[model samples]
Target: EAEVAQSPRYKITEKSQAVAFWCDPISGHATLYWYRQILGQGPELLVQFQDESVVDDSQLPKDRFSAERLKGVDSTLKIQPAELGDSAMYLCASSHRDRGPMNTEAFFGQGTRLTVV
Candidate 1:
Protein backbone atom coordinates (compact mmCIF):
# COMPACT_ATOMS: atom_id res chain seq x y z
CA GLU A 1 0.00 0.00 0.00
CA ALA A 2 1.15 3.53 -0.69
CA GLU A 3 1.42 6.17 2.01
CA VAL A 4 2.60 9.72 2.60
CA ALA A 5 6.04 9.93 4.22
CA GLN A 6 7.20 12.43 6.87
CA SER A 7 10.53 12.68 8.57
CA PRO A 8 11.63 13.34 12.14
CA ARG A 9 8.30 12.41 13.67
CA TYR A 10 9.19 14.51 16.67
CA LYS A 11 10.95 17.83 17.15
CA ILE A 12 11.90 19.98 20.09
CA THR A 13 13.24 23.50 19.94
CA GLU A 14 13.58 26.55 22.09
CA LYS A 15 11.61 29.61 21.20
CA SER A 16 13.24 31.70 18.46
CA GLN A 17 14.92 28.69 16.83
CA ALA A 18 14.28 27.48 13.32
CA VAL A 19 12.65 24.19 12.46
CA ALA A 20 11.69 22.36 9.32
CA PHE A 21 9.48 19.44 8.35
CA TRP A 22 9.51 17.31 5.23
CA CYS A 23 6.85 15.33 3.44
CA ASP A 24 6.71 13.00 0.46
CA PRO A 25 3.27 12.31 -0.85
CA ILE A 26 2.07 9.09 -2.36
CA SER A 27 3.18 8.63 -5.94
CA GLY A 28 1.09 10.32 -8.64
CA HIS A 29 -0.82 12.50 -6.25
CA ALA A 30 -1.48 15.93 -7.70
CA THR A 31 -2.49 17.82 -4.61
CA LEU A 32 -0.53 18.12 -1.38
CA TYR A 33 -1.45 19.96 1.80
CA TRP A 34 0.11 20.93 5.08
CA TYR A 35 -1.90 21.40 8.26
CA ARG A 36 -1.30 22.37 11.84
CA GLN A 37 -3.23 20.84 14.72
CA ILE A 38 -3.11 22.14 18.22
CA LEU A 39 -3.57 19.69 21.06
CA GLY A 40 -7.31 20.19 21.39
CA GLN A 41 -8.20 21.84 18.14
CA GLY A 42 -8.97 20.53 14.71
CA PRO A 43 -6.29 20.73 12.07
CA GLU A 44 -5.94 24.01 10.20
CA LEU A 45 -4.83 24.11 6.61
CA LEU A 46 -1.52 25.92 6.33
CA VAL A 47 -0.76 25.52 2.67
CA GLN A 48 -1.82 23.60 -0.41
CA PHE A 49 0.19 22.79 -3.47
CA GLN A 50 -0.70 21.40 -6.86
CA ASP A 51 2.14 20.20 -9.06
CA GLU A 52 4.88 22.40 -7.59
CA SER A 53 2.70 25.50 -7.63
CA VAL A 54 1.02 26.93 -4.62
CA VAL A 55 -2.77 26.76 -4.84
CA ASP A 56 -3.67 28.22 -1.47
CA ASP A 57 -1.63 29.73 1.33
CA SER A 58 -3.86 32.42 2.76
CA GLN A 59 -3.79 30.87 6.17
CA LEU A 60 -0.05 30.52 6.34
CA PRO A 61 1.96 33.15 8.18
CA LYS A 62 4.34 34.26 5.52
CA ASP A 63 6.58 36.20 7.82
CA ARG A 64 7.64 33.14 9.75
CA PHE A 65 6.53 30.14 7.73
CA SER A 66 7.17 28.97 4.22
CA ALA A 67 6.51 25.86 2.14
CA GLU A 68 7.73 24.51 -1.15
CA ARG A 69 7.36 21.55 -3.47
CA LEU A 70 10.39 21.94 -5.70
CA LYS A 71 9.65 19.11 -8.14
CA GLY A 72 5.94 18.73 -7.69
CA VAL A 73 6.45 15.62 -5.59
CA ASP A 74 7.99 16.04 -2.15
CA SER A 75 7.55 19.18 -0.04
CA THR A 76 9.08 21.04 2.84
CA LEU A 77 7.64 23.42 5.44
CA LYS A 78 9.80 25.63 7.55
CA ILE A 79 9.24 27.87 10.53
CA GLN A 80 11.82 30.49 11.37
CA PRO A 81 12.20 31.72 14.92
CA ALA A 82 9.76 29.23 16.29
CA GLU A 83 7.67 30.50 19.12
CA LEU A 84 6.04 28.85 22.11
CA GLY A 85 2.64 29.20 20.52
CA ASP A 86 3.91 27.30 17.52
CA SER A 87 3.85 23.96 19.29
CA ALA A 88 1.57 21.58 17.45
CA MET A 89 1.38 18.59 15.18
CA TYR A 90 2.13 19.27 11.53
CA LEU A 91 0.35 16.97 9.12
CA CYS A 92 0.88 16.31 5.44
CA ALA A 93 -1.80 14.93 3.16
CA SER A 94 -2.09 14.14 -0.53
CA SER A 95 -4.83 13.34 -2.98
CA HIS A 96 -5.22 12.67 -6.66
CA ARG A 97 -8.26 14.83 -7.25
CA ASP A 98 -8.07 14.46 -11.00
CA ARG A 99 -8.40 10.72 -10.87
CA GLY A 100 -11.72 9.01 -11.25
CA PRO A 101 -14.32 9.15 -8.52
CA MET A 102 -12.96 6.29 -6.44
CA ASN A 103 -9.56 7.88 -6.10
CA THR A 104 -10.72 11.02 -4.34
CA GLU A 105 -9.65 10.06 -0.87
CA ALA A 106 -6.67 11.85 0.68
CA PHE A 107 -3.92 9.95 2.46
CA PHE A 108 -2.25 11.50 5.48
CA GLY A 109 1.16 11.00 7.00
CA GLN A 110 1.90 10.20 10.64
CA GLY A 111 2.69 13.88 11.27
CA THR A 112 5.52 15.70 12.97
CA ARG A 113 4.90 16.75 16.55
CA LEU A 114 6.73 19.93 17.40
CA THR A 115 7.38 21.33 20.83
CA VAL A 116 8.60 24.85 21.36
CA VAL A 117 9.64 26.09 24.72
Candidate 2:
Protein backbone atom coordinates (compact mmCIF):
# COMPACT_ATOMS: atom_id res chain seq x y z
CA GLU A 1 0.00 0.00 0.00
CA ALA A 2 1.10 3.51 -0.66
CA GLU A 3 1.91 5.65 2.34
CA VAL A 4 1.98 9.24 3.47
CA ALA A 5 5.60 10.10 4.20
CA GLN A 6 7.07 11.81 7.26
CA SER A 7 10.45 12.08 8.87
CA PRO A 8 12.32 12.80 12.07
CA ARG A 9 9.77 10.83 14.07
CA TYR A 10 11.30 12.57 17.06
CA LYS A 11 12.98 15.89 17.64
CA ILE A 12 14.39 17.79 20.55
CA THR A 13 15.15 21.47 20.49
CA GLU A 14 15.74 24.27 22.88
CA LYS A 15 12.97 26.80 23.18
CA SER A 16 13.03 29.50 20.49
CA GLN A 17 14.80 27.38 17.91
CA ALA A 18 13.48 26.79 14.43
CA VAL A 19 12.40 23.33 13.28
CA ALA A 20 10.90 21.82 10.18
CA PHE A 21 9.09 18.66 9.16
CA TRP A 22 8.35 17.06 5.80
CA CYS A 23 5.64 14.91 4.30
CA ASP A 24 4.60 13.26 1.05
CA PRO A 25 0.99 12.29 0.55
CA ILE A 26 -0.29 9.21 -1.18
CA SER A 27 0.01 9.38 -4.91
CA GLY A 28 -2.85 11.13 -6.77
CA HIS A 29 -4.41 12.62 -3.67
CA ALA A 30 -5.46 16.21 -4.23
CA THR A 31 -6.09 17.41 -0.73
CA LEU A 32 -3.56 17.50 2.07
CA TYR A 33 -3.62 18.54 5.72
CA TRP A 34 -1.29 19.16 8.62
CA TYR A 35 -2.40 18.62 12.20
CA ARG A 36 -0.99 19.16 15.66
CA GLN A 37 -1.91 16.93 18.58
CA ILE A 38 -0.97 17.64 22.11
CA LEU A 39 -0.35 14.54 24.23
CA GLY A 40 -3.96 13.90 25.09
CA GLN A 41 -5.97 16.10 22.76
CA GLY A 42 -7.27 15.17 19.36
CA PRO A 43 -5.43 16.41 16.36
CA GLU A 44 -5.98 20.09 15.62
CA LEU A 45 -6.08 21.26 12.07
CA LEU A 46 -3.08 23.37 11.31
CA VAL A 47 -3.38 23.74 7.56
CA GLN A 48 -5.16 22.31 4.54
CA PHE A 49 -4.16 22.31 0.92
CA GLN A 50 -5.95 21.71 -2.32
CA ASP A 51 -3.36 20.83 -4.88
CA GLU A 52 -0.81 23.61 -4.57
CA SER A 53 -3.16 26.15 -3.07
CA VAL A 54 -3.85 26.69 0.59
CA VAL A 55 -7.45 26.07 1.60
CA ASP A 56 -7.25 26.73 5.31
CA ASP A 57 -4.69 27.62 7.93
CA SER A 58 -6.68 29.54 10.47
CA GLN A 59 -5.59 27.40 13.39
CA LEU A 60 -1.94 27.60 12.54
CA PRO A 61 0.02 29.93 14.78
CA LYS A 62 1.06 32.32 12.05
CA ASP A 63 3.69 34.07 14.12
CA ARG A 64 5.64 30.85 14.52
CA PHE A 65 4.32 28.42 11.94
CA SER A 66 4.23 28.26 8.18
CA ALA A 67 3.55 25.52 5.63
CA GLU A 68 3.60 25.00 1.92
CA ARG A 69 2.71 22.47 -0.74
CA LEU A 70 4.67 23.95 -3.57
CA LYS A 71 4.23 21.15 -6.10
CA GLY A 72 0.90 19.95 -4.83
CA VAL A 73 2.58 16.69 -3.96
CA ASP A 74 4.92 16.99 -1.01
CA SER A 75 4.81 19.56 1.78
CA THR A 76 6.67 21.03 4.69
CA LEU A 77 5.69 22.70 7.95
CA LYS A 78 8.10 24.95 9.73
CA ILE A 79 8.17 26.55 13.13
CA GLN A 80 10.42 29.51 13.57
CA PRO A 81 11.64 30.09 17.09
CA ALA A 82 9.71 27.19 18.49
CA GLU A 83 8.33 27.40 21.99
CA LEU A 84 7.81 24.85 24.73
CA GLY A 85 4.10 24.90 24.07
CA ASP A 86 4.92 23.79 20.54
CA SER A 87 5.77 20.32 21.75
CA ALA A 88 3.35 17.95 20.07
CA MET A 89 2.84 15.45 17.30
CA TYR A 90 2.77 16.96 13.87
CA LEU A 91 0.76 14.73 11.59
CA CYS A 92 0.40 14.90 7.84
CA ALA A 93 -2.67 13.54 6.15
CA SER A 94 -4.11 13.40 2.65
CA SER A 95 -7.49 12.69 1.12
CA HIS A 96 -9.08 12.30 -2.26
CA ARG A 97 -11.55 15.18 -2.20
CA ASP A 98 -10.93 18.67 -1.03
CA ARG A 99 -14.45 18.91 0.44
CA GLY A 100 -17.30 16.77 1.62
CA PRO A 101 -17.00 13.76 3.90
CA MET A 102 -17.34 11.01 1.33
CA ASN A 103 -13.63 10.53 0.86
CA THR A 104 -12.53 10.93 4.41
CA GLU A 105 -9.90 8.24 4.44
CA ALA A 106 -7.24 10.55 5.67
CA PHE A 107 -4.06 8.50 5.90
CA PHE A 108 -1.65 9.68 8.57
CA GLY A 109 2.07 9.70 8.93
CA GLN A 110 3.89 8.47 12.01
CA GLY A 111 4.23 12.13 12.93
CA THR A 112 7.13 14.31 13.93
CA ARG A 113 7.05 14.63 17.66
CA LEU A 114 8.65 17.90 18.63
CA THR A 115 9.97 18.56 22.08
CA VAL A 116 10.96 22.08 22.92
CA VAL A 117 12.73 22.88 26.13
Candidate 3:
Protein backbone atom coordinates (compact mmCIF):
# COMPACT_ATOMS: atom_id res chain seq x y z
CA GLU A 1 0.00 0.00 0.00
CA ALA A 2 1.18 3.53 -0.73
CA GLU A 3 1.49 6.26 1.84
CA VAL A 4 -1.53 8.54 1.75
CA ALA A 5 0.33 11.74 2.52
CA GLN A 6 3.97 12.89 2.71
CA SER A 7 5.48 16.06 4.18
CA PRO A 8 8.51 17.43 6.02
CA ARG A 9 6.81 16.62 9.34
CA TYR A 10 8.30 19.49 11.34
CA LYS A 11 8.99 23.17 10.94
CA ILE A 12 10.25 25.88 13.23
CA THR A 13 10.39 29.49 12.18
CA GLU A 14 10.69 32.94 13.61
CA LYS A 15 7.70 35.20 13.85
CA SER A 16 6.89 37.32 10.81
CA GLN A 17 8.50 34.81 8.48
CA ALA A 18 6.94 32.64 5.84
CA VAL A 19 6.59 28.88 5.87
CA ALA A 20 4.98 26.36 3.61
CA PHE A 21 4.07 22.69 3.75
CA TRP A 22 3.01 20.18 1.18
CA CYS A 23 0.91 17.08 1.22
CA ASP A 24 0.53 14.37 -1.39
CA PRO A 25 -2.84 12.74 -0.92
CA ILE A 26 -4.21 9.35 -1.86
CA SER A 27 -4.51 8.71 -5.58
CA GLY A 28 -8.28 8.81 -6.00
CA HIS A 29 -9.48 11.02 -3.15
CA ALA A 30 -11.48 13.99 -4.38
CA THR A 31 -12.18 15.82 -1.16
CA LEU A 32 -9.09 17.26 0.57
CA TYR A 33 -8.79 19.25 3.73
CA TRP A 34 -6.19 21.06 5.82
CA TYR A 35 -6.73 21.13 9.55
CA ARG A 36 -4.91 22.78 12.42
CA GLN A 37 -4.68 21.20 15.82
CA ILE A 38 -3.81 23.24 18.86
CA LEU A 39 -2.36 21.94 22.12
CA GLY A 40 -5.40 20.27 23.63
CA GLN A 41 -8.09 20.72 21.05
CA GLY A 42 -9.29 18.58 18.21
CA PRO A 43 -8.26 19.46 14.70
CA GLU A 44 -10.04 22.47 13.25
CA LEU A 45 -10.78 22.79 9.59
CA LEU A 46 -8.76 25.59 8.03
CA VAL A 47 -9.55 24.91 4.45
CA GLN A 48 -11.28 22.37 2.29
CA PHE A 49 -10.96 21.72 -1.41
CA GLN A 50 -13.14 19.65 -3.62
CA ASP A 51 -11.09 18.82 -6.68
CA GLU A 52 -9.11 22.09 -6.85
CA SER A 53 -12.10 24.23 -5.98
CA VAL A 54 -12.24 25.65 -2.52
CA VAL A 55 -15.35 24.48 -0.70
CA ASP A 56 -14.86 26.32 2.56
CA ASP A 57 -12.25 28.46 4.27
CA SER A 58 -14.27 30.45 6.76
CA GLN A 59 -11.78 29.80 9.52
CA LEU A 60 -8.61 30.37 7.55
CA PRO A 61 -6.75 33.59 8.25
CA LYS A 62 -6.90 35.06 4.82
CA ASP A 63 -4.43 37.76 5.69
CA ARG A 64 -1.59 35.34 6.38
CA PHE A 65 -2.67 31.85 5.46
CA SER A 66 -3.34 30.37 2.08
CA ALA A 67 -4.09 26.91 0.74
CA GLU A 68 -4.46 25.52 -2.72
CA ARG A 69 -5.00 22.23 -4.49
CA LEU A 70 -4.49 23.34 -8.05
CA LYS A 71 -4.86 20.65 -10.70
CA GLY A 72 -6.62 18.53 -8.11
CA VAL A 73 -3.55 16.45 -7.23
CA ASP A 74 -1.14 17.50 -4.51
CA SER A 75 -1.82 20.47 -2.25
CA THR A 76 0.07 23.20 -0.43
CA LEU A 77 -0.51 25.34 2.64
CA LYS A 78 1.37 28.52 3.37
CA ILE A 79 1.61 30.93 6.22
CA GLN A 80 3.25 34.31 6.15
CA PRO A 81 4.12 36.43 9.13
CA ALA A 82 3.27 33.56 11.35
CA GLU A 83 2.31 34.42 14.90
CA LEU A 84 2.76 32.54 18.15
CA GLY A 85 -0.88 31.53 18.03
CA ASP A 86 -0.21 29.77 14.77
CA SER A 87 1.97 27.10 16.30
CA ALA A 88 0.20 23.82 15.84
CA MET A 89 0.03 20.55 13.99
CA TYR A 90 -1.15 20.87 10.44
CA LEU A 91 -2.90 17.72 9.28
CA CYS A 92 -3.89 16.96 5.73
CA ALA A 93 -6.61 14.49 4.95
CA SER A 94 -8.30 13.24 1.82
CA SER A 95 -11.25 11.03 1.04
CA HIS A 96 -12.83 9.75 -2.13
CA ARG A 97 -16.34 11.14 -1.92
CA ASP A 98 -17.77 8.73 -4.40
CA ARG A 99 -17.33 5.93 -1.93
CA GLY A 100 -20.35 5.39 0.27
CA PRO A 101 -20.38 6.29 3.95
CA MET A 102 -19.12 2.92 5.17
CA ASN A 103 -16.00 2.96 3.01
CA THR A 104 -15.20 6.67 2.84
CA GLU A 105 -12.55 6.67 5.46
CA ALA A 106 -10.32 9.72 5.36
CA PHE A 107 -6.62 9.03 4.96
CA PHE A 108 -4.49 11.43 6.97
CA GLY A 109 -0.92 12.65 6.85
CA GLN A 110 1.65 12.44 9.64
CA GLY A 111 1.21 16.21 9.94
CA THR A 112 3.67 19.06 9.87
CA ARG A 113 4.26 20.50 13.28
CA LEU A 114 4.95 24.21 13.16
CA THR A 115 6.38 26.28 15.97
CA VAL A 116 6.54 30.00 15.58
CA VAL A 117 9.36 31.40 17.63
Clashes of each: 0, 0, 0
Residues 1-117 of candidate 1: C-alpha lDDT, one tens digit per residue? 999999889999999999999999999999999999999899899999998999999999999999999999999999998999999999999998676657577799999999998
Please report how far candidate 3 places residue 8 from its true position, in Å: 1.3
- lDDT (0-100) at residue 42 of candidate 1? 91
Q: Cα lDDT of all candidates, in order?
A: 0.95, 0.93, 0.91
Candidate 3's residue-wise lDDT over 1-117, tens digit each? 756675778999999999999999889789898999998999999999999999999999999999999899899999998999999999999988765556877788999999999
Best by lDDT: 1
After superposition on all C-alphas, the RMSD of every candidate to the true structure, in Å, is 1.2, 1.4, 1.2
Off by over 4 Å in 2: 98-102
Candidate 3, residue 21: Cα displacement in angstroms equals: 0.7
**Model 1 scores what on Cα lDDT?**
0.95
Better of 1 and 3 by lDDT: 1
**What would the per-residue lDDT of candidate 2 be over residues 1-117, giving only the tens digit for each residue?**
999999889999999899999999999999999999999899999999999999999998999999999999999999999998999999999989845656568999899999999
The regions of model 3 sitting more than 4 angstroms off are 98-100
In candidate 1, stretches whose alpha carbon ends up further than 4 angstroms from where it belongs are: 99-103
Better of 1 and 2 by TM-score: 1
The window of 10 residues in a row where model 2 has the poorest summed lDDT is 95-104
In model 3, what is the error at residue 36, expressed in angstroms? 0.2
